[model samples]
Target: MTQTLRFLEDGLASDQIVALLDLHLREMHAWSPPCSVHAMSVERLRAPDVTFWSAWDSEHLAGCGALKHLDAVHGEVKSMRAHPDYRGKGVGKAILVHLLEQAKARGYSRLSLETGTSDEFAAPRGLYAAHGFEECGPFSDYEPDPFSYFMTRTL
Candidate 1:
């Protein structure tokens, strides 16, 4: 499939995107403690500091990811999820690559992310690790949480 990644200023307005995000939120809530579920709501993702992107395979949305500017030289990856039907199809990796490129383009010196430390998040953790992200201490406004794993990679 030919997948294209494009910036989305109002992704939450799309039912398809909203549904995917809803699923993501549900999964996060189900797997992590309430305080550990840091997944952003669709409304929060539309904030000025967040740049959201959707990956489309022709007419279908395959995956989505976001970059949240934390500082002049730092960025945080957020809301990365692949459509249920698009799993194992490189959709998530494509979104991650796109987010990383966007961070570098914005002159970020570092990229970081927070994900669950449970089996449910093993794949995502592996994906980030493969992209050179190493386990790190909590960053930005995050605090230490046993259920959360923080990682960062230098740009």
Candidate 2:
């Protein structure tokens, strides 16, 4: 039998969560310049407009993702990351599906995201494409950037 993936909307006050988020930040900076790295800091993810959740398999953290309200009809996917030990186990997909569901529940008409264009990001890009996201120009506060690729899907 498959173990259920538990999504927890916590207080974001735990050391483990902060450490994972910081790891995500470091990875983002490694792949792009400071100007091109759009991953949110821990403090930023605490904003009122952002809703964040972590995926867990029993007591183990599988991954995490967040959705940011851009407008009444638009939402942005943010801060997605699978724990290193959970990389090939559907953790990312689980987090993404949760975000998409949350977006739809909130009546968002569309969802968008920004990710790197490097080879390191091919897997994530593929995952998004498989889930109906299509390549698009930058959205919201973003500008044209070679290091970044944008994707959006109607909800």
Candidate 3:
């Protein structure tokens, strides 16, 4: 894949972007309720603290991810998705690495994420674990949610 990744704001309007979010929501709905709480609409993703990044194979959108600044030293991973056509093709890993690199560059000391605690979320949990995040209690404004698993990594 001849891929290029770029930072974007107001970027969720594209049909491909909408499709990716729909897939994410569909997958999450089948997860436990608490896990489902972490899902957000594209409108919510445009909040000021969030920075979104998207990966493209030329004109085709391959995947997208986002990071939200929780505080000076803390960041949260959000809205990670890989196109169905690109799953298992390293598109997610590449986007994740790029997001992590951006977090480090911004001097964040800890990176955190929330994912479903169900079979559907296994791959996402595994991906975060491979990147050095260890399971942890909820951070920031999150309350305990049975469907959710929180993980963190110190930069």
Candidate 4:
């Protein structure tokens, strides 16, 4: 399905967006230990260093994701999730592509992210790998953890 992207200044102003974000966080908690979860809260996404976006299939919300400016030459991907109704519909890929474009536009030389290492995260891991995000050591403030899988790609 065709989707349009909308920039969210404060992350989620509408109730539909809010619901989607809530689901994203709940799933993160379910799949990863609290300390290992790097999903951003709405407030964090509102920070000056972060930019969030949502994909919409017409009036319906399809997915959401964010890019965080870690420094002059680096960016971090955060809070990527497809709405249940839109799973497997390319929403996540679209968001990831958008985040990469944004990172490049800002002149970031590298883009990195932390995802889960559990069996449940295999698909996401594959997605990142397919997009040229290879396994990497943690970037920014993140520390190594068994539950965390770090990936990075030169932008």
Best by TM-score, which number? 2
- For 25-78, candidate 1 gives per-residue lDDT tens digits of 999999999989999999999899998887777778888899999999999999
Clashes of 1: 0
lDDT scores in order: 0.89, 0.91, 0.84, 0.84
TM per model? 0.95, 0.97, 0.91, 0.93
Which ten residues in a row are the worst by lDDT in model 4?
Answer: 2-11
Which candidate gets the maximum lDDT versus the true structure?
2
User: Which runs in model 4 stand beyond 4 Å of their true positions?
Assistant: 3-11
lDDT of 3 by residue, 29-105 (tens): 76666345687778888788888877887777788899999999999999888888889998889888988998999
Error of 1 at 110 (Å): 0.1
The residue-by-residue lDDT of candidate 2 on 1-155, one tens digit each, is 01598999865788878999999999999989999999998889999989989888888877889999999999999988998989988888888888999999999999999999999899999999999999999999999999999999999
The TM-score that candidate 4 achieves is 0.93
List residue ranges in candidate 1 displaced over 4 A: 2-10
Residue 100 Cα positional deviation in candidate 3, in Å, after optimal superposition: 0.3
- Residue runs of model 2 more than 4 Å from their true location after superposition: 1-3
The positional error of residue 38 in candidate 2, measured at the CA in angstroms, is 0.2
Ranking by TM-score: 2, 1, 4, 3
lDDT score, candidate 2, position 65: 92
